[model samples]
Target: MKYTIFSTDLTNPLAVWQHFEGEERVYWHDTQVNRVIVAAGRVKRITEAELADYPWAWYSQSFFDTIEDPIWQNMGNELVVFTHYYVKEEGKAYWVTATDSAPVIAPMTVPSVQHTYEMVTTGDYTAWQSLFEGIQQAIRSGEVTKVVASRKVAFHSETPFQTASIIGNLVAQNEGAFIFAYGKGDAVFLGASPEVLVRKRGQDFMSYALAGTLKKDDIHDGGDRLLHDPKNLREHQIVIDRIRQTMLAMCDKVDVQATHIMELPNLYHLRTLLYGHDTKDSILTMAKALHPTPAMGGEPREAALAVLKQFEPYERGLYAAPVGWVCGNTPLFREAGDGLLIVGIRSALVHGQDLYAYAGCGVVAESDCEAEYTETATKLQTILKAL
Candidate 1:
């Protein structure tokens, strides 16, 4: 139950990720706070029951096991990895946390290589139409109120993709996001995500209701139109109501901040931050309770998920799942330390020369198939620009 700390340079943290080419690695960079964590090499495989002993670990879980897919299955479909080598970088200071005393590791040289690739959508308009029709039918029939629909696009390159390059590009181009890269051998799951599933700092807990989206184009009034659009408002309110109820059940006191627009490089999201105080639940517990929060899974959680399972042509895997890290020092200790889990939207999975990127949007009864499709395609640009 001991860890060693040592000084290290993290000016170019992506180089540190490249250094451990042969080992499993996990990278987490919170751009808002300017904090980065890079962990490599596995010491032990952690279970749900072992959270107390190894509270500090990287967590990545699949959206849900709706279908069997080997690509994601090989990448540890539904597993959380605990590593021996962990490094934390905040501002100008850098330090390592490990289960054993390890030597000062040097960053590897990341070669500047230009890559060429072709892109193809996994599903076509007809496929998207079918899914949209299905969801609309369900909503009209009162089987479900809203359902989030998603699709995948694949990029095929002549040469194998470099994980370090992608990570570096994501950090440089994307702002106000949690930049992440999790790699094991030839497969890597990476993205720049803006939605927080849940974040815990001691007894203070917070979750974001980020549902409505609008392109931040010159034609539109930035986020002003998104703020007043009735369809978008209804979609966003669904998320706020669900999260508020869940927080109230677990917390002694809860407060939802004023609604505002979360502006990303490509789009704007209606965001309402919720806070819960003095909770006995742990980070993992809070994350599990709030994941796929209408923002991803849709309204009446279970019913929407069922609709997705029946209509979504591709497996979501970790696309919109809860992915993050947890920290603590003792058992049954809800008061221990801090942790944050973010919804894995705007993400991609890399296998050798093939990279599959995913994006989704909420579809209420009033949603139009063509409009939703365009929105999702625009959202995919977050990862495409990085590539």
Candidate 2:
């Protein structure tokens, strides 16, 4: 039997299926661009018999080559398969989708709630100190400008949870922002970030390159003054310059705004908003050009990544990686091709009761070990409160 393809514009919500148990299914409102195709249920992979179960034309990322696809032709398309669960006083269940849009709502009996816990604790302070010392020594030798390092703590609990619920909570509390939660197998990532590396809203491309950091002190009278501190200015300039250079190589027309200050709950940051027009390159090409920016990774991508791989104790996976959606197969929206990627800062991975969270600070020539440590601790609070 042939199935009807149900693709919707970014503004329209489409009916999407989300699996609970291997046998149970629910409908959710998918208002975003990415299409959902079922590869498997909780009990098993999708079988020929289950084809009828999914009446809508389904798609999967198994075949598409991101690097080869054109940005405009595959607009409104996304390629990540996410498995998420939400746990709270209300109930516990899991849902998988490719976009952030809410799923189609369906009336169904709630499943039996399971009790579980996952705890994430930090590594020993001594180990952190040792890493910091090594980083400082590298700075003295002039091998790098900045290096961002992090650690994780994982604990397990019996209950299952929803990744969207956690993201919703964080985004609701912070507006004009992006919240992301993507999990594959045992690894999960959830972050509420205000900084946008790049957004394609049509033919127009916008980017906010943010760098420099300062902890907010309630007692300080001229706290905002810290945004312009020479150390902070220098840090931010490096990021702006790196982003501008990258954009120029891949974009047809690029314009950058003067640096400005943006405030978060814990601190102030320096941000430079950029506008650009996409070239003929695919989104993946543009992404490759811009990623590992000085903001998330560091200046001189290859060298910085080398330092991280050698010194960092854990693999980053998608921790500081890009997370968002892509849609629209049109030229104007080529870069925006229905895709939105937010930096995975202020994020956590929750399973059972154990929530694995991570935070990293940019360490530059003038960076103080104690100050960077404090900055990471402050960033962790975004996810820590929900747990």
lDDT of 1: 0.81
lDDT tens readout by residue for model 2, 1-387: 221232322221111222332321211211232222222223223332332332221112211123232211322223422232121111222233333533444543333233355453555456677777777677778777776666655545555555445544554454444555444343345666767766665555677888877777766633468665888788788888888887788778889997877776666778889877855554445565677678877766667777776676655555666655443332212322434555667766555356677787787888877777888888777776544
TM-scores for all candidates: the values are 0.92, 0.70
Candidate 2's displacement at residue 198, Å, is 1.7
Model 1, 117-209: lDDT tens digits are 888665578899999999999999998888999988888999988878888888888899999988876788999999898999888899999
Instruction: Please tell me which predicted candidate would have the highest TM-score against the true structure.
Output: 1
Please give the CA lDDT of all the candidate structures. Answer: 0.81, 0.54
| The 10-residue segment with the lowest total lDDT in model 1 | 328-337
Question: What TM-score number comes out for model 1?
Answer: 0.92
Candidate 1, which segments miss by more than 4 Å at Cα?
47-55, 65-67, 74-88, 97-104, 107-113, 330-337
